[model samples]
Target: MVERCKACGFCVEFCPTKVLALSSAFNSKGYHPPHVVNPEKCSGCDLCGMYCPDFAIYGYKLETGQAHVATAASAVHRAQRGPGNQSTGVEDEG
Candidate 1:
């Protein structure tokens, strides 16, 4: 998804854990995409994906009992509903 990033820095600037930083390397689109800076600190909150206008980045947590990995598409979908309902973007399957 680095190729989809447009160097807006929203992912880097808005990450709650500061897990992302703008990379010096350029993408094919000539924009600097964000890279993970501190993976251990990442909460997999997907805030970066929520903030990305280009749908470029996302994060997901893995739990012992979880059946499926949370998807970035869900995070992006939730973001469209506005800011008040933010969650971990993990939907439980019944």
Candidate 2:
């Protein structure tokens, strides 16, 4: 959030959890930028950064159940998503 975002809707569209929303205020360029409307629901997927043409916004996976960037959170997300392995399409049976 240091540089001015160019109001490219890529981040908002690519956000898996739909955490971003266009703000009512405009940037220096007079374009409606986005803001985190739902931080708690974010998973730090970073899809926004990958899609953002301006490289203005990015998200960090929060695993501590708190709304902030943390290294531990990233580790937790990695563990949850996959441990460098693809799903085998086999369901676990208890």
Best by lDDT: 1
Per-model TM against the reference: 0.66, 0.61
Residues 4-39 of candidate 2: C-alpha lDDT, one tens digit per residue: 566767777878878677667665667776766655
In model 2, pairs of residues that clash are: none
lDDT for each of the candidates?
Answer: 0.56, 0.53
Instruction: Indicate which candidate wins on TM-score.
Output: 1
Clashing pairs in 1: none
lDDT of 2: 0.53
- Report the C-alpha lDDT of model 1 over 4-68, residue by residue, as the tens digit: 77888887788777866777877787887666555545666777767889877766654531111
Alpha carbon deviation, residue 26, candidate 1 (Å): 0.8
